[model samples]
Target: MKRVSCIDIGTNTALLLIADLDTQEGSIKPVFHKQTIIRLGKNVDEQKIIDHEAMQRLISCMTDYKHISKEHDVQQIIAAGTSALRDAKNRMEIIDEVVRACGIVIKTISGEEEAALTFSGAVAGMEELPETFSVIDIGGGSTEITMGNAQTITGSVSMNIGSVRLTERFFSSQPPSEEEFNAAKEEINRHLTEHLPPFFEAREHVYGVAGTLTTIAAVVSGLEQFDPEKIHNFRLTCEQVGNLLDMFRRQTLNEIMDSGIPEGRADVITMGALILHQFMKLLGTESIRVSIQGLRYGMAWKELQKLVSDGETTNSA
Candidate 1:
């Protein structure tokens, strides 16, 4: 039983997954899972660079993850940086700092690769899946829509419309005004309309993964603490998404914080809900099934598969 770790450094948060991978069975037994919101994409959209404060926060978070991985004696760590890093002008500074400090190389993955990995991870552990489906991963700086089946990915697109980017661009006041909400919704709809139709032609079932969807599931379930089991595979209807969007839009940041929306996410969850809502409306889907599995899971699975393949080749030779 070998333990491997995977880290997904996104625009909004950094997530780490440490698991005992059973190569023979192709199963992953989770050992530790944690996420920290470092706002790594802060100002990246407007300034085109990672801010100094945000970089420090990300470094601290990665350092902590490194310590935890060491504690678990992880044999390998695969870290991938997404939208924020890809967009930032000064990304190499953060990458250099991370390697110098934590001894982990950060791979800045392209949008297509991100979508492919997400598609693989989102469908890996599921007991049931449609013959054809879509996986929508909404991150902080970008949204990845991947359509494929159990075996291969056919069409995938990553758009620049995300919760943080949308909120920063549209929401000007506390508890955004109706005009602001409408404006944001329209912008998101426009982006999806342009990019998502090709993938939606034949895909019927859409599964929503990543923080935004999971947080909505937690708040909707009214759980005092986050629960992956309850969130995973939970079906959310278009009407429910609309109702939640309305409910969240009226509440101030403090109110949302008080309502058990995860800390550091209260400000952007409303926009996130809106993104999900607009995506469903564009695709004409009535509901989306949420999955806890995401990029980190997909990375870990890929690594394990490679190891399995290497072993088989050596044994045959």
Candidate 2:
């Protein structure tokens, strides 16, 4: 078993997962996990920049994560950066500063890689997953849809539409005006119709990960705060998703937050929920099983595999 931490740095949040990866069991046992919203991709969609304040928030967050990892006595730290990092014009500079200050190296992954990693991680958490299944990971800046099984992936794609991106681009108010709502919907539709192909559509047994899905699950379960044990593996149906859309459709951000959703999520969740609603509608999906495990767990599994390989090489030498 190897004790390692995988940091999933996204457009809106930075999630940390520390786990004991057992090669023999092909399993990851969680030791610690944390999620922080820093909005790393705050204005990347509009300006293609990470900005100074965002960078400062990132460095400070990473520093805390570093101290936490040390407290847990983790052997390794793997920092994975997604959409925000992928589109940032000054990513390298931010990355260099992160290394200098926090001793963390941020590896920005492509959309395809993010999809595959998310798929692998989501399925790993489930007690029983189908031979053929797909996963949709909706983040702050991008959404990844991946179709695969236990062995290999058949199809995967990532789109540029996301909660924060849409919120910043179109949402002028909490619930947004009718025109703004229609405009956002149009943009979302264009991405889905143009980029997502026939193969990825009409998938059943879809697994969903990331903030958007989990927050919805929490709402469905009627919990004021997050409860991963209850939330994980929860089945969310099409009607439920639609109902959430209707519920949040008229509520302002403050109202949404008062309804129990966290501040980090309340503002953007309407857009996020809409993305899920539209995805399910277009794809003809009946339901999705929520998985709290995502990119970080996938990274943990990969790290374990590499560790096993390195050990074998050392023995041979």
Candidate 3:
């Protein structure tokens, strides 16, 4: 059993997953999984750069992840930066700083690659998923919608509309005003309608991944603490999503935070919910199945395959 560490640095959260890869079984067993919301894309939409304070927060989180990975004796560390880093003008500065501080190199991945990895990770262990379904990853900086089955990806699209970006752009008010909410909804609809392919609407089974969807599932389930087992494969109907959106819309940021939503996510949960709501409406799905497995899991699986392939080549030679 070889321990490998995979880090996914996104706009809102920095995630660390350390797992033991069983080469013979081609499976990854999780040893540790943790997430810290550093808001790396806090103002990237407006400023086009990762802010100084946000970068510091991200580095702090990475330092903690590095310590944890070392404690677990991880053999290989794969760190990836998405959305925020992809859009940041000074991403290299941030990357260089991270390497200098934590000795971890972060790879900035494109949106298409992000979607593919997310799809692979989202369905990795779920045996009940429909043959043809959709996977939606709503991050702080971008939203990736991938349509695929167990075997192959049919089509995918990555849109610039995300929770942090939308919140900053439209919902500046604490609890967004009706006008702001409608404006954000309209914007999300416009992006999906104009950019997403027709196949997205045609998919019958849709699985929601990432923080926004998972957090919403946790809140809706009335959990005092977050639990992945309960959240994974959870189902949320369009009506339920609408109900939650209305519930969130009426509450202030503090109230939402106190109501079991993650500490740093309260301000943007409204916009996050709206993103999910609009997508469900556009796709005409009654509900979405929530999958806790996401990019980090997919990245681990991909890395394991590469390692195994290299080993096989060496043996053959």
Question: Top model by lDDT, which number?
Answer: 2
Clashes (N, CA, C under 3 Å) per candidate: 0, 0, 0
Overlapping backbone residue pairs in candidate 1 total 0
Candidate 2, residues 36-106: lDDT per residue as tens digits? 99999998999999999999999999999999999998889999999999999899999999999989999
Backbone clash pairs for candidate 2 read none
Q: Write model 3 residue lDDT over 1-317, tens digit each, in one string.
A: 57889999999999888988776677778889998999999889998999899989988998899899889888889999999999999999999999999899999999999999999999886777676888999999999999878888988899999999989999778788889888888899999898666656445798889999999999889998898999999998899889989889999988888888877898889889999998888878888999888999889989878868867323210
**Model 2, C-alpha of 242: deviation from truth (Å):** 1.1
Q: Which stretches of candidate 3 lie over 4 Å from their true place?
A: 312-317
RMSD of each: 2.4, 2.5, 2.5
Error of 3 at 288 (Å): 0.8
Q: Which tens-of-lDDT digit does each residue in 1-317 have in candidate 1? A: 57888999998989999987777777777899999999998878888899889989988998999999999999898999999999999899889998998888999999999999998998787876788899999999999999888888889999998888878889986599999989998899889889977877644698888999999888888889998889989988888889988889999998988988877898899999999998888789888889998999899888878878877323210
Q: lDDT score, residue 15, model 1? A: 93
